[model samples]
Target: MPRSLKNPKKAKRKNKGGAKKGEASSSSSNGIPSIPAKVWQPGVDALEEGEELQCDPSAYNSLHAFHIGWPCLSFDIVRDSLGFVRTEFPHTTYCVTGTQANSAAANSIGIFKISNISGKRRELVPTKTSNADTDMDSESSDSDDDEEAVNDGPKAPVFQVRKVFHQGCVNRIRAMTQRPHICATWGDTGHVQIWDFSSHLNALAESETNISKDATTVSNQTPLVKFTGHKDEGYAIDWSPLVPGRLVSGDCMNAIHLWEPASDSTWNVDNKPFVGHTKSVEDLQWSPTEQSVFASSSVDKTIAIWDTRLGKSPATSIKAHDADVNVISWNRLASPMFASGSDDGTFSVRDLRMLKEGDAVVAHFTYHKRAITSIEWSPHEASTLAVSSDDHQLTIWDLSLERDEEEEAEFKAKTQEEVHAPTDLPPQLLFVHQGQKDLKELHWHTQIPGMLISTAADGFNILMPSNIESNLPANTAAA
Candidate 1:
C-alpha cells in the first residue's frame, strides 16, 4: 500500500543543463525552437485563497490615492488652530531648482483641503482587461466605452483645491505650528518668503466659485516678510514649533540664518549666520519641547545641535555618519530624543542627554537600501516614526518593542547572510507602504490619528492603518 509502489514510475534522466528528461528538451519535435516556460520559484510561504499573510512589520492598508500629474519635490501638512488638516504640494516642470526664467515660470504649489462627506463611499475596482483586437476602429470604440463606464461609476474621493500659489520651484515649505495661516517657503532665488493665507481663506469661504479658476499669483500679493541672505538657493527651512514668528533657514552655501519678524512687515536676520558645517545644510528641526533648541544635519556627515541664544558654535556636535546626513526629526513626546537619516541608507536614534564626543547613537536602523530623503516622528505617539527612502518605500516603525536575545541573535545572522536584503524588520516595525513611485516626502496628519500623507514623483497618497475605514464621503469626486 506504499505510495511509491502504487505510482511505479521510472527515474527520469537529467540533461546537461540539469533539466529533467521530459520537462524541457534541448530541441523541438517540429523543427522549431523550444521556449521553456518560466517556473514559479517561491521566495516566501504561499498563502491560501482569501487568507492574509502575517509578517513582522504589519502592512499599510491604503485608504485613498490621488495622482497630481507633476513631480513633487517637497510637501507639508498644515493643521490650522481650528484643527483642520490641509495638504500642500510644490510642483515644478523642471527637475532642478534653478534661477533661470523658465524655472520660475513653471513653478506652482497646489493646496488641497480634505473634507469628510456623508453617506458616500468609493471603492477601487480592478482594472479591466483590454480587448485583443488591434483594429483602429475597434480601439476607438473601446476607449469611448471605457470613458463612459468610468463616468457612470460611483463618485471618487474629492480633493478640493483651495488655492494655488505661483512661485519659483519651491524646494521647501513649512507651515507655522503656532500660526497655521502663516507659511514660509524658499527656493532657487535664495530668498525666503513668508506668506499669510488668512485673507485667501476668508475669500474662499465667502465665494461659491472654484478658487482654482482665479488662482492668486505670488507676484501680485506681497509677502509678509522677505529675507535675502543666502548667496545661493535655499533648500531647508523650519518654523519654530513652540515659538511664534521665529524661523530658521539653510542655504546651499553652507550658511544658516535665524529670522524674526520686525514691526514694519520685515524680517530681522542674524548679522552673523551659523557657520560650522563645511558643506550644505540638508535639514533643520526645532525641538518640540524647547523653543530655543534646534538641530541641523549637513552634507559634512555631521549633526549639530544649536541653542539660538549662543553665537556660531553649536552646543553639541557629533560625527553622525560616514556619508551625508539628509534629514533629522525631533521626538515630540520625549525631550532630548531625536533621529537622523543619512545618505548611507541608515538612520539612528540618539538621546541628547547621553551624547558625548564619540558614538552617541542609541540605536541604528539600516533597512532602507537607498538614501533617506525624509524622516518624521509621530506627534501623537511617543515611539512611532515614519521614513521615506529613494527605494520608493515609506516605512513606519514602532520603537517601543523589546526583542529577546534569541531574536536579536537571529536578526544579526540574517543581516550578514543577506547584506542587501531589507534590514530585518524589528518587532518595532508597524507598516511598509508601497504603490507610489519616486517617493520624496511623508508626514503624519495632525488631526487624524492613523492617517499619513505622502507625495512622490507621479502622485500623492493618503494612507490609513489596516484597522481603520475610509473617512471620505460617498459623493466625492472621482480621479
Candidate 2:
C-alpha cells in the first residue's frame, strides 16, 4: 500500500558542517553556493513515543471531491480575480495530421468556473438603528423601510459553463495572465488561433445573468487573429507572462516559432524558427523572471534555454533525461531554477547558477512508475511542485527543506548496510493523488492557495488538501 502523508514520522537528527567525498561544499572557492546533494528524505511529522497509527485505504479520496468527465488533451486556468478554467478536447477519436487524407475534425474548448459555496450563503443584512426622534426623520424612515423589505435567502452556488468554442484538435491551450478573457490555442494544423471574449463579458455584465448555464458553442465565428508558420502540427504554446501579446510555440518537427501582434490586427511571425532539437519539441516555458528568456524540452532527450533576442542557437542546453523530455517548468519564485520530467519515469531539478558542463542536475527523483506526462511549479509555494504520470497518479512534492551534514552521513551509512532496499523514493514526496485514469495534465491554481485542477482522459478534477475549509471561494485562501 502507498504511504499516507496526512501524518508523517519524524526523522532522527545528525551533526552539521562537514562535506563528504565528491560532495559539493557549502561555500565554494568561487564565492558561489555549491549545489547540495539531493538525497534528503521527506520530512516526517512528530508523534508521541510508542504511538501507533492505522492506515485507511480511502484517505486519498478526501484530497479531492469534485470530478467531471471531460476528455481533454490540454487545459489552462484563467488567472483572473474570478477563477475560470478552459479545457480543450479533440472532436475526433484520434488526433491525426491535418493532411487531406486524414482530415481530423476540430476540437472543443470548454470554459468553466468552479462553484463558490461561501459566497452564495453570504447575505447582506442591514444593521438595526436606535434613532426614533432623529433630525433627519424622513431619511431614517426610508432606511428602516428598505431594511424591512430586504430578502435574506441564501443563493445557490454558481457552477456553470462560460463558453465553448469548436476549433481544431488543440494540442495546447494557454490563457493570457495579463488578459484573462483572451486565450490562445494551437494544434496539428500548424496554425495558432487567438480568441477574445471581451464582448461576451460585456453581455454578461449588462444582463446580470450567467449565460454559462446555457453553454454557448461557437463554431462559425472566426478567431480574432490567426498565425501559421510551423511546417508540421504545433504541440506546445505559451504566452509570455512578462511581455504583452508576445507568444512562443513549438511543433512536432523540432521547430519553435515566435509570434508578435502587428498593428494591422494580424500577428507577425518570425522568418526563422528556433531550430536545434533533433526530435520533436514537446514543451515550452517562459522564465517567470526574464521576459526574453524561455526554455524548450524535446524528444531528443535535452532541454534548451533560449533568449528571444539572441540567435537561433540555444544559450545553454543540457541532456535532461534518459528518454524524451516530456515537460519543463520554471520555478515561479526562484530565478534560474527549473524542473523537467521525462519518459524515463524520473524528474530532475537543475539550477542554472550552479550548473557545470558535465552535471547540471542538482537533484533527481525516480518514484513515478511510468513516464511523466506533465509537471508544474506551484505559484503559491516556491518549493512546492506537482507531477502527473502515465501510471494514473499525481504527486505533490516539497523541496524546501534540507538535511544536516551529519544526518546525510548517517543516511549513507544505513544505505550501505541495506543495499537491496527500495531507494527510489523522493525525499520531498508530500502527497500522492490517485484514482484518476489516463492523467495528462495538472496545474496549481494561480489565485487560490493549495488548490489544484487536473485533466485526464476520463474527466477533470478540482482538488485541494483535505484540511482545506469548505467555505472558501475558488479564489480565496482556505482556512
Candidate 3:
C-alpha cells in the first residue's frame, strides 16, 4: 500500500486516533468515529515509543508500493504506446531500472510492465462561501442505485518484468525518448552500452502472464553497441529529444562524448571529448527544442550551456550553486526554462534567456536538508516540478505560487482551530511525500496526469496524491 501524506494546513498531532476540541469528527453508517487526518513533519514531529506511522487510504487517489529483489539507484520511465494524456482510472506504465548488486556479475537491468493500477478518483468539494460553480440540484436527483453500481473495490496492481544481464553494476540507465526500447546504460566498467529491448517490450505488451523466461537468460541478452571510450566511470547521460538517436554521455574524468547514429543498431562516438567542466559532469539534458543545444551541471559547482555546432567549449557558463551540482531537468513544455539541484540540497529554476543576459535566477529554494538526489520537471505541467533528496523526502512544487496575504488571512480565519503550519514554509511548496528510505530517483508518468513513481532503497512507490490538482474533465466523478 502507498503511504499517506497530510494536508499542508492540517496540524501535526502526536495522537491522531481522536479528534481534538474544535475539530468535528463524523460517524460512519456503523456509528464508528472517523479519525481525522494529520500531517507528521519529519524531524519536527516525534512519535510515541509504541506508535508508528500508518497509511491513510482515504488520503490518496491511488497508491501502491512494490520492490524488486535488488535496489535500483537509477531508473527511467519507458514510454509506451498504451495511450497519451491518460486521465481515467486503472492506469498502466512501463519503466527501466538499473540495479546495484552485491557482485558486478550479478547486476542486471530490469524492464517492467506494470498494469491494473486502480483507485478512487477524487472530486474537490467547494466551500459554501466559495465562488466556484455548483450542481447540487442535479446531483440530488441522481439515483443511489447508479452510484452503488460504480463502487466496486479497487483491484490489486500487477506487473511483469524482463531482466537483461549487464556486464557490470549499472550506474545509470536511460530509455530513449523517441525509441524507449533502445536504452543506454552507463556501467561501472567505464563503458557505455546501447541495448535493444524491442523483443522484450513486444513480448510484454502482447502477452498477459506467459512472457518468455528466455528474455532473462544471459545468452539472449547482449548490447547493440558498447563504447569503451571514457577513461573513467560516470553517471551523466541523456538522449536528444529533438533528434532521434543522438546522445551525449559524460564521465567522471570531466569528458563528454557525443554519439550519432551510424546505423539502426550502431552509433559512432566522436574520439575527442567535450572539455568545459573542470570536474565530473554530474548530469546532462538535451534541449527540448534545439537539436544541438544542451545543458550540463557539474561537481565544479557550475552549469554550462553547450551547442555542438559551436565547438568543444561551453557557449555560456555560470556559477549556479555554492556546492556540487547533482542533477538537471530541461522543461519540455517551456523550452527556455530549466531546473537544477545541487549537493547542498538546494534546487533552483533558471531561464536560459535571462542567464544569457546575466539576470538573476527565476526561483531558488533550500528546503531539503540533505543533498538532492533527483529532480525533474513534470512533462504535462510547465510550471510544476518534483524533487527528491537524500533526506528521504519527495516534494512537489508549483513555480507560479506565491504568498497571498488576503487568501492566507481568509484561510486562517476559516479553519483556525483545525489548521496549522510553519510560517517559514514556502508557498511554492505544494506537497511533501515521505515514507521512502534513501530516495534515489523520481519520475512523473508522462501519460498519467498526476501519477508519480519514486525509487528508493526501500523499493518503489507509485502514488497519485489527491491534493495535487490536474487538468481532468469536469464531469469526472469523485471518490
lDDT of each candidate versus the true structure: 0.59, 0.58, 0.75
Q: Over the full model, what C-alpha lDDT does candidate 2 score relative to the true structure?
A: 0.58
- lDDT string, candidate 2, 1-479, tens digits: 11011111112111110111112333355576544222222122222343222211112111222221224667787655333321111000101011011123423555554332211111122122222211111111111212211133222223334444444455678877787667778755677778775555444434423333223554355678777667787667788889877888888889998888674246788869998899999899988889899999999999998998888989988888899999989997886679999997899988888666565677799888788888998876777889998877788888865545576567557544322222445557766665556678888876555567776654455555432222334344322
Model 1 worst lDDT window (10 residues) = 133-142
- lDDT at 44 for candidate 2? 27
* Sort by lDDT, top down from the best: 3, 1, 2
Count of clashes, each model: 5, 1, 0
lDDT of 3 by residue, 1-479 (tens): 01111111211212211111112323344466644435656656665543355443434566666555567788889988877677776678889987776777777888887777666565543123221121111110111212211124433455667888887677789999888989999998999999999987887788665233234454347799999899999999999998889999999989999999988898999989999999999899999988899999999999999999999999989999999999999999998888999998899988887875774489999899888889999887899999998888899999999999898777767654445456778899877777677788899998778889998776677778766767666344332
TM-score computed on alpha carbons, candidate 1: 0.69
What's the lDDT of the predicted structure labeled candidate 3? 0.75
Sum up the clashes in candidate 2: 1
What TM-score does candidate 2 get on C-alpha atoms? 0.67
Stretches off by above 4 angstroms in model 3 are 1-37, 125-152, 210-220, 405-417, 472-479
Question: Highest lDDT among the candidates is held by which one?
Answer: 3
Which pairs of residues clash in candidate 1, taking residues 3 or more apart in a chain or in different chains? 120-473, 120-474, 121-474, 156-477, 156-478
Ranking of models by TM-score: 3, 1, 2
